[model samples]
Target: MTTTQDFPAMSGSLQEPAPFWRRRTGTVVTSAALVAALFGGVTGGVVGALNASGGGVAAVSSPVALNASSTSDVSTIAAKVLPSVVQVNVRSGQGEGLGSGVVLTPDGRILTNNHVVAGAQQVTVTLSDGRTVDAAVLGADASSDLAVVQASGVSGLTPAKFGDSDRVKIGDQVVAIGSPEGLQGTVTSGIVSALDRTVTVPGTSTGRRDSSVSYQAIQTDASINPGNSGGPLVNAAGEVVGINSAIYSPASDGGQAGSVGIGFAIPSDQVQQIVNRLS
Candidate 1:
């Protein structure tokens, strides 16, 4: 029962909605089961029981101080946006994963990559203020690797301002925030390396039925990793232009992974559609 309040969502979405499976269980059962699986066992029960009676979890409010030449107003942007950013943790029988997400509405609607929360029996979202809350999967589209989750018993949440990803060009600076390698609230900065690039994402049984979707991505040099998926890719203006999705690891080392100064993000225009549908 080691309860990690904040987990990060990674990856991003692509154009054209892909078909996905819907969980049949009611939101209550699914959420309860998720919490139980994570905090009910002997290892988890102690923390779960403690938190269950210890009132609600506190939220993290401190924002990361980002430094970039073009971001002279970085403090204003970070302060305005940090409240909407959240750390997501997904747990299943096998193990747990981490990623990041954006709160889409004041009522606690959040958007993140389907791959980040895929196969998760339970999901918990931690706000920037250190408050931890249970989340429910509203809908997930695996083909696009996008999913929407909602948090309960939380209010006054800030939503991220969306930017035009289509207008983003190569060489523009971008920032990413997520829990890389389980280290929560990590931030990295880089420039858009490429645009409208297409890459193939290996299919998952739990992913969209389309088998694969070609992405119109914003390539960057940001240090994206397993836990950085589903996080926001912000432009120099501090607007969310893309969602951090994947990185290209050279095939040289027998598929051993390494950053080659290349990473990709799902364009924001496409994300609007999904978020609108969820809202």
Candidate 2:
């Protein structure tokens, strides 16, 4: 019955969209049964139930920019970005849920998915150096599925360098970092499989059942899982091009969901736009 994990898919449009089957993360069962749906104006297939699943601009200062042409190796990228990634844990009367986040400022401003902290009463974040600190939600926008949390009395934290997602192209190398299944600081690599993908998920700004949050997501082959939500999907240059969000997992016999190479991230530009407001 935890709320942070499930992210049921919704339908929308793209200039030239293609049909693709999609689903949410986690195995936690909710009240509803699984149902089929379309994504991006194409009759893809059924979108799964909620598993129960950053930015830029003038409002926030930028991190040191890495040389995009210098390297795209996983180790180098992970080394540069790891310090900014964190494991986010939330607790409510209903229960607890886990996700991830990216540090936005040295003073401890963080960027994460709105669903990760939705309905959360207490929130804490584990930094890359194994420090768990208390945090307070500064703002949350369900329509964009983005949020910002500020850690108490923390300073000198490394903020992630964000790249321009609009410049990302298919076949570009990318790396995803997050805490999957509570495993903090895990790193995975893949390519930009597609772009301008319209993905709709089950929550919205109005908190209405009929309304959904539709966003243009960056499609990738990176192995994203449940706890990976809100993590950084970085480019080879060690700059975050997107925020790792959801994955499209086919239903298995046990009804458990895992990454099947089809993962989606909220474009960094959109993340910047939303986070600039949230932070």
Candidate 3:
């Protein structure tokens, strides 16, 4: 489930927003049946049976240790943002999807990719501390492939600070945090590779996985995978700059093709615009 791999897979044009659905880098399981569900109901009884295993914001001032040129700032950024990030596992009657999300409110608002929870009858969200909570879809937009969910029993949490994507520059150091292939709390470091690039991806919320949506994106070399969808891409200062939404892959099945260091995220400015409309 690591994004450190830098190799080319099948040659061709690039496809966007496909879940890092391949074999999971030998760690993530795409099928909800095989992956370890952290909660009951849609996530299976695993979490319920165990009563859940154990386990956000500046309540966020920036971590002072961050050094853009030192290379060690990746951890500082991850530590500041991971608390707001979560692992999302969803199940519908016929199928399921696994992805990551970020907490937006102390009272349980969550933001994630539409493809991850689309049509899901059941959704289980695992917090950074390992506690799992059931969630319900509140709103979804297939056109942008973004969605929001509401979780029960949460309050007074730290929210992620949104950054101005228009200010993001090429080669800026960044960090991506997500549960790639169901592996929670995974962090990858890289630089913004491109910005304002248009990407077209199939719609997962409508069940028409073959359909496509076009939107401007923030491209980064940070390691993002199939399960990394909807996760946050934070800057050196720990403010979320974009939502990791898609990646450039060449596989036809889409699932078989893996990341080649090129990944795309929905910029925070656009994300905030959409969230404002939905919320």
Candidate 4:
């Protein structure tokens, strides 16, 4: 089932569609035994999104340095950041969800949205290098909508550098990297529309704001679609500033879904704290 969240205060004569948290579905909890289910070097469709963006993509064979010196240009930043971003495919029994993730460490640690991997029975991470590896969730925090997963066996990983969201100013140039509509490694560009915006989400509990989860978000005008969840929202310098989480679907055509040039992300500062505990 597709679910969304929005500002309850802005109710109109015709209620608008709530912004969707994640475009996909699935909530079956799997055990750690899943780590041994897949055979080594045996690749199967992991049910993921394939990311593609406006600018051209660099060859997956070339090693793009995550710390490469980058100017305030979009292509330059993408070349550096793309190598660190990954496509996350999760399956929970008969249900499956698609999302994106950023490499947090050279050892294959990944950071993504909790809604993306929550209750996932199996997870497969596809690197920019065209290799897929098995992943296991370390921990998930629903309050922040963030989660961390670690690869069982992987090497030569390129980790994205996260920036200080506290010093981020409004109108700064930014980019969104993720798999939109099953397109993996897609990049989109935009400016920071707002800062520290308060957003409420439908939580594990039911009934309106009583049991909702709120988050301090970094708002952007980037085109983040359903599959973009858990991807990294990076700065012009190729540093990750936030984790792409939700998008604002406008009240049009009976509330058409997808990004309407309005997207929200969990600030990197909050993500850092969550990943710290997971690591």
TM per candidate comes to 0.71, 0.75, 0.76, 0.73
Q: Candidate 1, 265: how far from true, in Å? A: 0.4
What TM-score does model 1 achieve against the real structure? 0.71
lDDT score for residue 267 of model 4? 79
Candidate 3 TM-score over all chains jointly: 0.76
lDDT of 4 by residue, 1-279 (tens): 212323333211111111122223322221111100011111111110011111100000001112222343667878888899887777654355566888988999998776666657788888998798999988877666677999878877999998877766677767777776557778777777777655654332111112335676776777766566778877656678788776554322222234556567777888898889876
lDDT of 1 at 245: 61
Worst 10 residues of 4 by lDDT: 53-62
lDDT for each residue of candidate 3 in 1-279, tens digit (9 for 90 to 100): 112222233233333333332222232322211222221112211000100111000000011112285655666677788888887777654445567888899887888877667667788888888888888888998777788988878776667777777777778877777776567888777788777765554445554353456667777777665467778877667778788765544323212334567667787888898996665
Poorest 10 consecutive residues of model 3 by lDDT?
Answer: 55-64
Ranking by TM-score: 3, 2, 4, 1
- Where model 4 places Cα greater than 4 Å from the true spot, the runs are 1-72, 204-210, 252-256
In every candidate, how many clashes are there?
Answer: 30, 11, 6, 9
Misplaced by over 4 Å in model 2 are 1-28, 31-72, 204-210, 252-254
The lDDT for every candidate, in the order shown, is 0.54, 0.60, 0.60, 0.57
Candidate 2 per-residue lDDT over residues 155-246, each given as its tens digit: 99999888888888777876677776566777777777778765555552321222456667777776665567777877767788887665
Better of 3 and 4 by lDDT: 3
| Candidate 1 lowest-lDDT run of ten | 40-49
Backbone clash total, candidate 2? 11
